[model samples]
Target: MVNLNAVLLISFLLFSIGVIGVLIRRNALVILMCVELMLNAANLNFIAFARHSGSVSGQAFALLLMGFAAAEVAVGLALVVALYRKRDTVQVDDINLLKG
Candidate 1:
């Protein structure tokens, strides 16, 4: 059986890495991917806790969160594609809110 502490540690590490990537990356696509990673990490934590507690609620919530993440990715990618077509670039720094 995997230790609960170990699972939590790994999830925390994944979350931290995702946060760093989102903060450091300038490309919109990279940022979006990092956000997804963070969401996955949270899902992992939910699953781990649910497994340890022998409850279905956390897993159910994780599934719902995944669905939301999927929708968010779809919309985010569409926006990125539209922005790329209009701006010819995906760099976050280059895109100005007022210009778009």
Candidate 2:
């Protein structure tokens, strides 16, 4: 049987990496990837706890979270594409506010 502590530790590590990446990276694509990593970490936590407790609620929540993440990615990528088209760059610092 897998240890719960190990799973939790791995999830924490993934989340930490994602947070650091988001804070340090300036590229819009990289930041989006980091956000996805963070989401996956949360999913891992939910699944691990659900298995440990022998309950499906956590898994159900994880599935719902996945749907939200998918929608977020779709919208985020659209924004990034729009930004690239307008600014000709994907660097976050180079893009100005939505104000025209």
Candidate 3:
């Protein structure tokens, strides 16, 4: 019995927080976590709209997005580990592997 407007508002707030976190945080891990937060907010929006419109496509897309986010996290973490091993730091400004 939750209202669609309320769900949308919550999702928007979550997404905004994630964006701000990503923008303000300097650690790579924190940035990745913020990205996950944003993805979850999008999934919430998908589920809410799916329920509101009486369709399963949005839910399906949300599920797929979850899988994609999982893979992205895995890859991103691996890269961070590698960078930390090579550079001894995970700060966004301290490591520059793409300076070419």
Candidate 4:
């Protein structure tokens, strides 16, 4: 059997990479992809715990989170598209309409 610690370590690594990408990247699309990566990392944890515990709650929660992630992606992409259309650029630093 694969060790739980190993699974958790991998998940942590994935999440950390996502966080670093989100913090350091300037492109909106890249940030969005990082956010998705983070969400998947969370899902991996949920599944790992569910497998370890032999219960379905964690899996159920993971499913719910997946749905939420999907909706978030849809809405986030729509907003990015709108922002690009308005500003002609997807750089996080350049499109600051909420600066006030």
Candidate 5:
């Protein structure tokens, strides 16, 4: 039998890795990918719990989160394109235009 707790633990580990990547990485594209990874990790946990508990609510919530994540990816990619066009680089630290 598949262990639900193990699945949840793996998901949590994946999320932590993504968080660390976002905090430490300088490249915009990499950071965006890491954000997606974190979102997916949460989704995995939701679905796993939903299946284990014999309830559909968690699955439904996971689906909803997936939809939002898709939209977020669309907007985030657009921003990345715009930023790349403007600066010709994808480093987040270099984006200090609004700084005083």
Candidate 6:
């Protein structure tokens, strides 16, 4: 039998790790990666709930989230590239344009 509780626990742990990374990391790349991790953790929960409750809604929502994540990644990476070209670093603290 599949252990739903274990899966939920693991998902929660992954999400928490992502949260910590976003909170503590200074590199923009690491922060983006953490955001991706968070999205994946949410996806895991969606799949888990779908399996446990036998509902298609969770799966559908998960698919939507995936699509949004992909778009966000594309836009975010583009912005990162632009910032790197202008500032030559991916550190969040160094790229201060509106620091007036």
Maximum-TM-score candidate: 4
lDDT of 5 at 80: 97
Q: Each model's C-alpha lDDT? A: 0.95, 0.96, 0.95, 0.97, 0.95, 0.94
| TM-score, cand. 6 vs. native | 0.91
Q: On a 0 to 100 scale, what is the lDDT of residue 45 in model 1?
A: 96
Off by over 4 Å in 5: none
Candidate 5 local lDDT, 12-100, one digit each (tens): 99999999999999999999999999999999999998998899999999999999999999999999999999999889999998995
In model 6, which runs have C-alpha deviations exceeding 4 angstroms? none
Error of 4 at 55 (Å): 0.5
Cα displacement (angstroms), candidate 4, residue 95, comes to 1.6
Determine which window of 10 residues in candidate 6 has minimal summed lDDT. 91-100
User: Each model's TM-score, in the order given?
Assistant: 0.92, 0.92, 0.93, 0.94, 0.92, 0.91
Native-vs-model 5 lDDT?
A: 0.95
> Distance (Å) between predicted and true CA of 81, model 6?
0.5
- The global Cα lDDT (0 to 1) of model 4 is 0.97
- Candidate 2 per-residue lDDT over residues 6-71, each given as its tens digit: 999999999999999999999999999999999999999999999999999999999999999999
| Over 4 Å off, model 2 | 98-100
Colliding pairs, model 3: none
* lDDT measured at residue 13 in model 4 versus the true structure, 0 to 100: 100
True-structure RMSD, every candidate: 1.7, 1.8, 1.4, 1.1, 1.1, 1.2
The TM-score of predicted model 2 comes to 0.92
